[model samples]
Target: MKEKSNRLLSLSAIGLVILFLIAARFLTTAESVRQSFWALVPPIVAITLALITKEVYSSLFLGIVTGGLLYSGYSFEGTLNHVFVDGVISVLSDRWNVGILCFLVTLGAMVQLMNRAGGSAAFGKWAGKHIRTRAGAQIATILLGCLIFIDDYFNCLTVGSVMRSVTDQHRISRAKLAYLIDATAAPVCIIAPISSWAAAVSGFVEGENGMSLFLQTIPFNFYAVFTIAMMLFLVAFRLDYGPMALHERNAVEKEDLFTTEERAGDESLERPLRQKPGEVIDMLVPILSLVLCCVVGMIYTGDFFSGESFIDAFAASNASTGLVLGSFVSLVITLAFYMLRNVLSFNQCMDCLPEGFRQMVPAILILTFAWSLKAMTDSLGAKEYVAAAVKSSATGVLSLLPFLIFLIAVGLAFATGTSWGTFGILIPIVVAVFQGTNHVMLIMSMSACMAGAVCGDHCSPISDTTIMSSAGAECVHLNHVYTQLPYVLTAAAVSALAYLLSGVLAVSGITDNPFVSLFGGLAVLGLVLLGIRGGAGTKAE
Candidate 1:
C-alpha cells in the first residue's frame, strides 16, 4: 500500500513538472528563458519520480518521453524526425558522446579481463592483507578514487570494480561506495589542472578570447575547490549522511546489508594462492604503464614542455584510443606472462575478452541515450534558450551575478547532463556580464558556471556520472541516485551560500579581489567544518 502510494505520488509530481515545463514554454518564446525553465523541469521531475517509485528504467524512460513530448510540441514533423532519425544518429556520431561511450565499453572490457586474470581479486587480496580496519579500507578506496581524476566515468567504474571486494570485506554498503565514487569523479575533475574539463574549458574560452580566459577563471571556481576539499574532509573525518550514515552505523554494529553471493568476493581474498611468481608483477606493470602513458599524454596535450606542439599531444591522448590501446597492450602482456609461466591457457584469455565486453552493455546503452538526449536538446536550441532566460532574469540583480551564474549553470547542466555544454553556454555570457565589473566579479562568475555545472550534474539523476556511479558500484541505479541526492544538495546549499557571500563582499569592495574572496570563502568553510565536527563529536560522546 505504501509503495503504491509512493508511486502515485511520484507520478503526480512528474505530471506537475511536465505541466510546468509546458507552461514555461508557452510563457516565453525567447530562447533562453524557454530553454532555462524547460531544462530545470525534466531532471527534477525524473529524480523525484525515481526516488518515489524506486524504478530506474521507468524514471529514465519517462524523462525520454517528456523530452520527446517537448520536442514534438514544437512541431509534430520535427518530433517524428528527431525520434526516428536524429536521436539515434546524434548519439552514435557525436565526437564527445562517442568518446564517452567508447571509454565505457573499454573500461567494462578491461575490468572483465582483470577479473578473469585474477588481477582484481589479486589487488583485493593485497589490500586485505594490509588494511584490516574498516575505516582504513574506506579511506584507501576514497584516496584511490581521488587519484583517478582523468575522467569521471573511468574513475567511477575503475575504482568501484577494483575496490568492491575490499569494501565489502569491511562491511561498507555499495550505496556508500557509489557515493564516494560520484563525489570524487566531478570534484576531482573540476580541480585537476590537466584533465578533460581543463581541455574542454580551455577550448571554449580559446574560441572566445583565447587561452587567457582559462587563466582568469581558475581562481574563482570555488565550488570545485571546496567540493574536493569537502570530499577529503568527509573521508578523513568519517562524515556520512542520512541513509549513508545509517549504513555506516550498521557497519559499526557488524550488520550485513549485502547478500552472501555479494560477499563472495570478500571470501576470494582468503584463498588467493594460485598465481605464478610474476602474475602480480604482470598485472602491476601494465597498470603502471597505462598511468605513465596517460600522464605523458596529458602533458603532451598541455604542451607544457618547451617547443612541444600541444595540439598533436592533445590529439594523442584520445581517451578512448588510449584506454583501448592500453587495455589491449595489458591483455597481451598478461597473456604472454601467463603463457610462458604456464599459468593460463590461450582459450581462457580469449574467452574473457568477450565476457568483458558483454558486461559493458548496460553502460553503453545508458551512454547512448544520454548522448542522444544531449544532441537532441542542443540541436533544438534548448541550451541557448536557458542561458538567455537566466541572463535576463538575473540582470536586475547584477550584484548577485556570481551566485546567479552558479544557479543558472547548475540548472543548465542538470537539464542537459553535460558540464561542457553548460560551460560553453555560460562562459561567454558571464564574461560579457562582467565586462566592466571588477575582474574578481568575472572570475567569480566563471567559477560559478564551472561549479554550478558540476553541482547540477552531481545531483541530477540523469547525469552520466550518476548513471556511471551506479554501474560502477553495482548499486541499483535509482537507489544510488536517491541515496546521494541529499548529500549533494547539502553541499550545494553550502556552496551557494558561499557564492552569494562572496558576491556581496566583492560588490561592496570588502573583498575586492579574487584571492581575497577565495580566502574569505575558505575561512567561512572552515568555520562551518568546525561546527560540523563539533556536532559530530557531541553526538559521538
Candidate 2:
C-alpha cells in the first residue's frame, strides 16, 4: 500500500511538471528555440525525475543534464564543456557565488564539529531531561530554530540536524521537523538584520535610494513577520496541516514515518540530563562571541566606526571577510575550551578538523551546481526577458504594481530556485518604475517582491535551503517536498491577498493611514485561519 501510494505520488508530480512546461511554452515571449527550450525543459525534467526516483543524486544529475542540454543544444561535446568546464569555473570565480559556497562549507564544518563534540547530544539530553511534555518539546524546537538567525542555510541544516534526535525521541514526525526548519529559514532571513540576506537586500535597496529603503519596506514585509508568527502559533496550539497533521498523529502512536540510521557513537542521550552549570555557558560563549565579532567586523570593514553611512558599511561587509573571520575565531575558542577541560586532546581535535572538512563535501558540491545553474541562466539573458515581459504587459496598471511584482517575483523564484536571482532581476525594474511616483508605493512593491521571492523559494524543492532541510532531517527528499507544499501554499495564498490589499490601499492614498492596510491584512489572515480550521475539522470528521 505504501509503495503504491509512493508510485501514485510520483506520477502526479510528473503530471504537474508536464503542465508547467506547457504553460511556460505558451507564456514565454522568447522566440528562440534555445531560450524557450531551456526555460521550459530543465525544471520539468529535474522535478519529474526527482519525484519518480526519490533520489537526491539522481534529481541533481538530471537537473544538471537538463541545464547542459539547454546551454549546448544537442551536441554532446558542447554540453560537456558548458556543464563541466564553464559551469564549475564560473561558480568558483564569482564573488557572491563564492561567498555562498564558503558559507555552506563553513556551516557544514560547524555542524560536524558540534556533532563530534557531542554538543547536539548534550542538547538532546538536556531537552529530554527537562521537557516532559510533547508541547514543551515542540516549543523548544521552534525556539531553537528561531534563535539561529545567522543564515537561513545555516539555520535550516544545523537546527534540523541538532534537534532531530530530540524531536524524534519525543515522538515528533520528520515532516514536522522539516516544517520547523523550513518555517525558520526564509522567515528568519527576511527579518535578520545581520545576515547574508541582509547584505543582499541592502544592496537592492541601496541601489534604489538608501537607508530609507530599508525603513519603508519593513512594515509591509507581512509574509516574513506573519510566517514566523504562524510557526510559533502552530507550535503553541500543536496545529498541523494536511499530511503533516496525520504524521503528528502517527508519531503519537510511536509509528516511525521513515527509517533513520542510529549513529554509533551516542544512543543513550535520549534520556536527557542537566548540563553542569558551566557547560551551557561554555557552549553559548563561543556562539555569542562569534556573533559579536561578526557585527564588529562588519562595522570595521564597512568603516561604520569611521563615520561611514549605513549603506556604505553594508557594502564593505559584502566581502564575507567578517563571516569567515568570525567563524575561525569561534572555532578556535571552542577548541581551546575543549583542550582546557581535557575533553579532547590537541591531536584528537586536529583529527576531527579533517572529518569536519570532509562532511562539507556534499554541501560544497550542491552549492557549486546551484551557482552554476544561476550563472548559466543569467548568461542566457533570462532575467532581461522576464523583465521585458513584465514591463511590456503591465504598462499603466500602476496600482497593481505591488501584486504584479509579487506574482512575477514568486514565479521567477520558483522557476529558478533562487530568491537572490529573483530579487536581483525585479528590484531594479520596480525601482525604475517608481522613480517619479510615490516612494511609499515603491517601498511596498519592493517589499512585496522580497516576500514573494521568499515564499516561492521556501516552496521550491530544488532550492538549496529546502534540500538542506530535507538532508538535515534525514527524510526522503521528495517526501519532504510533497509534505511541505501544502503549508507553503497556504501561507502563500494569505500573502498574496495581503499584497493585493497593500497595493490597493497604497495606491488609493490610504497607506499613510496605518489602520486601513493593517485591518485589511488582518481580515485576510482571519479568513485564512478560518479556512484552515474548517478544512482540518472537515478532514477529521
Candidate 3:
C-alpha cells in the first residue's frame, strides 16, 4: 500500500512539473527561452525523475521530450521532429559517437570471449587465493583503474571487466564496485600528465604553454587528489556510510550484492563459472594487448609515424577513433588466440560476436539517450548562457574567483552532463581574467575549474564516465549515482573550502604554495572521515 501511494505521488509530481514546463513555454519568448534558465530544465527534470522513480529509460526519454518541447516552443510537429531528428538522430549521425559505439561493442565482445573461454573464472580463482579480503579486492580495482588512466571510458570498462570477479568473490556490492571504478576514472585521468583528459584541458588554454600550465594546476587540484585519499581511507578503515553502507552491509551479511529488486540490465554482470578449464593468461593477454594497441592507435591518429614526438602525438590524439581501432584489433586477436589455444572452437569464438553486442545494448541505449539529451541542452544555448554568466560576474570579487568558478563549473557540468563542455566554457574566461596579471592566481583558478568540472562529472548521472562506470560494473545506473553521491559530496565540500583558502592567499600577495592548501585540505578531510567513522561505531554500540 505504501509503495503504491509513493508511486502515485511521484507520478503526480512528474505530471505537475511537465505541465509547469509546458505553461512556461507560453510565458516566455522563444529567443530568450533557450538562453534563460529554461535551457537547464529538461535535464533537471530527467535527473529528478530517475532519482525519484529508479527508472532510467523512461525518465531519460521524458527528459529528452521535455527538451524537445522546450526547443519547439510547445509545438506538436516541431517537438516530435526535434526530439527524434535533431536530437537522437543528429547525435547518432556523428562520427565520434559512431566510433565510441563501435568501441563499446568490440570491448563487450572481448569480455564475452574471455568469459566463454573460462579465462575470467580462472582469473577469479587465482585472485581468490591472493585477494582474501573485501578491502583487498576493492583496492585492486582502484589500482587497476588508476593504471588505465589513458582514458576514463577505457578505465571504467577495463577495470570493471577485470575486477568484477575478484570483488564478487569477496562479496563486494556491485554498486561499490561501480563507485570505485567511477572514482578512479575521471579523477585519475584529470591528474595524469599524459592522459586524454590532460590533452583536452591543455587545448583550452590560450597565450601560454598549455601543457606547462596544465602541469602546474595538478598540485592545486584538491578534488582529484582528495578523492583518491578518501577512497584509500574508506577502504583502509572500513568506513562505509549512507546508501553505500547499506549496500555493503547487505553484501557482507546477506551475501546480496544488489540489495534491491531493480537489477535492470545487470544480469550480464553475473558470471557462471565454466566447466571448461583455462589459464589466467587468457584474461591478462587480451587486456594487455588492448592497452598496448590503444596507445599505438592514439599516437597513430595523431600522426606519430609522420615524426611527431610521443607526448605531442598523445596530446593531439582522437580518443574515439583510436579506441575503436585498438579495440577492433584486440577483438580479432582474442578470437584467433582462443581458437588456437583450443579453449574454444572457431565456431564458438565466432558466437561471441552477437552475444557481445547483446550485452552492450543497455549501455548503448543509455549513451544514445544521454548524447541526445546533451544535444537538446546544446540546441537551447546552455553553453552560451553559462559562458555569459561566468564572464559577467567575474569582474568583481577577484579573491573569490576560484571559489565562484568552482561553484559555477559544478552547476554547469552537473546540468549539462559534460565536463569537457564546462571546461571549454569556463577555462577561457578564467584565462582571460588572470592571464598576464597574476600567474599564481591563474593557476589556482585553473585548478578550480578542472577540480569542479571533475566533481560535477563524478556525481552527475548523465555523465558519460558515470554511465560507463555503471555499465562496466553492471550495476543499476541510478544505484551507482545515489550510493556514490554522499561520498562525492564529502570530497567536493573539502575541495571547495580548499579553493576558498587558496584564492585568499593568491589575492593577498602571500606565498602561493600549493602544498600549504593541499595539506590543509587533506587535514580537513581526515578529520571529517574520522568523525564519520566514530559516529558509525557509536551507532553500532
Every model: Cα RMSD to truth = 4.4, 4.6, 1.8
Judged by lDDT relative to the true structure, which candidate is superior, 1 or 3? 3
What is the C-alpha lDDT profile of model 1 across 1-541, one tens digit per residue?
A: 9768976887787687668667856764434433544544445555566666666556655665555556566466766666547776756776656666666665565555556566666677687889987668767877887898876766788788778878877777777778878888987877665566666666655335424555566677777667666656666666665556665665556555432222212233223233543245534654665565555545554453655555434423455545444444555665676567665567765665666567666666766666656665665567668767767865677578778888888877877777877888887777766666556676677888889999988877678888888788776666576667766776677778778887887777676566665666666666665676667521110
Q: Tens digits of per-residue lDDT for model 2 on 1-541?
A: 9879977886776576556545654554333544343553565466557657675455665566556655655467977887777776866887766665665556555555555555666666777889877667777777887887756765776677667768877887777788778888877777666556766776775446444575567677777766776665566445667767666776776566553332211223222122432244434554565566655655566778799875567655653666666566667777787678765567766765655556555556656666666655664567777878777755778778778888888777876778888888888887877766777777888888898899888877677787777656756556677777777777677777777777777677766553455556656665666667667721211
lDDT of 3 at 372: 92
lDDT of 3 at 106: 92
Clashes of 1: 5
Of the candidates shown, which would achieve the greatest lDDT relative to the real structure? 3
User: For every model in order, what is the number of clashing pairs?
Assistant: 5, 1, 0
Q: Is candidate 2 or candidate 3 better by lDDT?
A: 3
Off by over 4 Å in 1: 1-36, 39-45, 74-80, 207-212, 251-283, 295-341, 393-396, 435-437, 513-541
TM-score of each: 0.84, 0.84, 0.97
Best by TM-score: 3
* lDDT, candidate 3, 405-452, per-residue tens: 899888878877888888998899889888898888889989999999
Give the RMSD in angstroms, all C-alphas superposed, for model 3.
Answer: 1.8
